[model samples]
Target: MYKLSPFTYTFAGRSKAKKIFLDSTLIFERNDTVAIIGPSGGGKSTFLKILKGIIPEYSSGKLEGEVLFNGHPLSGVYFQENLQKILYLFQNPFSQLIYPGTEEEFLFSMENFNFTREQMDREKEKFEKLFNLKNIWGKKTSELSNGECQKLVLASMLAIGPDVLLLDEPTAFLDPTARKEFYQYLDVIRKDRLLIIVDHHVDEIRPLINKVIFVDHDGHITPGFFTKNNFVVEDISLPKPKTAEEVNVTVSDLSFSYHKDRELLKEANATFKSGEVVAVRGRNGEGKSTFFKLLSGILKPKKGQILLEKNGKTYKNDKIFPHVGFVFQNPEAHFFFDTIEEELKQSFRFLSKEHTVLKDDLLSRFFHDIDLKKSPFLLSEGEKRRLSILMTVFLEKSLILYDEPTFGQDQKSIEEIIVLIRELKKLGLIQVFISHDDYLIEKIADRVLVLEAGRLYEVPRA
Candidate 1:
């Protein structure tokens, strides 16, 4: 059992320090499976870190009140004794997966708890079977896909037999089928343990969750019941195409492979027209990100041509950089400036040389509540995503490629993105994005491209 009595946390800021948690009280029993819901940058992740005793130890913050574990205060001796019994999984698996190979990572976690060789092997086999990670046992961690990384981290955590499991967006990167499998596995394994999940996919996991806690913008926590009506997705309308037959980019006989034995894309072909939103949908590790990289000139095809046709001129893959803008799946990787404002200004400088620069008021409207002076690296995951997309849109590229645009966003942020997409389409810009969000694809996509068995097939919009 765990208890937090009138807990409060604060972080350093420019004018004044900001309070992330405002004297909140929460309790978790042995068999509780609770879901945390909130808006983007609403301190859900911070609350989890606080519960795990990470805020005062690893971060510079002001903390008050007591966090007790099993009727004892969490201190040096108590925390060290119960370290193996509590586990916290980060939102990004890359932070938790430190070992080079999967096998070493799994073994290292088990050995930390003094598991014998035989016990380690037994637990490793059980977890591998449970998470379906046999195919990636020998692969390097860097080479695994996002979903694969998530599975590996989860397996490693479960191998230790923790009494409490704190997962932050465990299925944010998974495809639909993989997410269902993960949830089913979690449901079976978390029967006796305390499981706390902070996720935006409320509707998908409603059946498995026992209680729901809402963290509002003011850092107040309120308990509620789970309901299917919590999420209401509306159908978004996009602008009509200027010319239905105008092809902006054409991929012909494209072939690519990360390894010699595994071909991710082979002889794939597709066409994207102007003034349209094209969604690329497929299973996890099915070359959706690979296709986006190829289109953005980040990776070149081994055999075939990717042509960008604009103003009666054709540009090949290597020459298409000027017309293409790419927003990576991890938005933190796209930042290069010291501050958020500098990052946006850098994009504007690259786009124009004259006085037609983007105004601060317009930029402020796009990032309504974010601090412009903060470092891009310090922003929350959702804030980083919005900044990344804003920079890409400022470039005014003829072709925009977004990979998982709504990964950690809340409902309001998603609605803002839909409006931005509509405005972009009205400007005759070609938009092609990879997403697992069915609602987004159904609402905004004019055409949906399904990548399967190394081929791109068109599916009718719903």
Candidate 2:
């Protein structure tokens, strides 16, 4: 079912008009599975955007790319012409649920894409049996977790039968077990369509990768099957964002509970210090986020107390954010504006106008630091996550608390985030990252704390 002619494309990132390509020029027929790998900020996400048409059109940074379908260019190719032929899975799965309530609407979307009534009837059973969506059949897309919603999106994508499938860091936020299952879906689809992926954990997914396209740190992309030469990323080095130093956060006998329920957290005693990126890890429902709430002043601890030590003053947990920056897991939950500019400007109001110069100085620190006026909410999920982190930095906080930052990011987004955290840490920000990523714990955290039930690991280990 492969079409002839060339499957070529081109694109760029940032305000600079220089074109960059991982596989700068790619010619593939149907059933070709390609993986784009590179260091952080290498434009993996940008490449996917070009393919998704988010680039050059809705995408910013002076786009100069062309994506063709069936030997025909996509310039005037409306989505309706091939709506059933392509589905793009962004890094953040939460924001992709744009349809009405219920899974029925989702199935109806598939029908709109030319899925037959018969295909619709057996779609749930077929998709569920393949990707495990039996329980999600009736659930609202909004209610599903990133992992669950991603699975549903994948199932729906498969049910609709797109000629080309693009997945942007689909498993970057998933746990090890969840990652393995996600790869199975990729393997299933690689056999029949043109599958292009932007990812970093290619070591674990090497077998699924039929070809590898690499984008180095400078946005230079080299494409081909994996070889010793393909792994060369001269600019891919760790950014030392923090220094090993004294503790900045002190949690003494911290206890919290929701209403009258069994204490969700009990006697949590831990101290987050400087010169170290401390990681907090635990199973879900262990009050990990609640602890963050207490530290950020979003929630008050019921029993014990938490204090943030800054410049010799001990501030209460409720007042942490005024001095410390905290980025919530769901940054959208805090957003009321419809545009990125409004969001930033509104948030800046928290600081007085007398500090206006300071505010502009801070906005320059957003990792984007370039063009930030595009549709903020309309940006990809990974991009939104980056903005959230960047906005926290713009606050110029003495301490930063990140909760599940990688929750729904693709590989490129996670890597950029890891770099951003290091840069901010080097600038003397005490960051506390909460996650279950062992690799992140090893790469960024100077100290790793595991929470078993309600207890924090106290012993330091190499």
Residue 421 displacement (Å), model 2:
5.6
Off by over 4 Å in 2: 1-25, 39-43, 49-67, 75-78, 99-108, 111-145, 215-222, 225-276, 282-291, 300-317, 328-391, 394-398, 404-430, 450-462
Per-residue lDDT of 125-229 in model 2, one digit per residue for the tens? 777776566645665665554556667676777777778888887765555566777787778767768888876565777887777777665566565565432
For model 1, how big is the CA root-mean-square deviation? 3.2
Reference-based TM-score, model 1: 0.91
Q: Write the per-residue lDDT of candidate 1 for residues 141-254, one digit (tens) a residue.
A: 887777788888888888889999889998988888888888998788778899999888888888888878888766676776654333443433333434533448899999
TM agreement with the true structure for every prediction: 0.91, 0.67
Candidate 2, residue 199: Cα displacement in angstroms equals: 0.8
Report the backbone clash tally of model 2.
8
Error of 2 at 52 (Å): 4.3
lDDT agreement of model 2 with the native? 0.64
Every candidate's lDDT: 0.81, 0.64
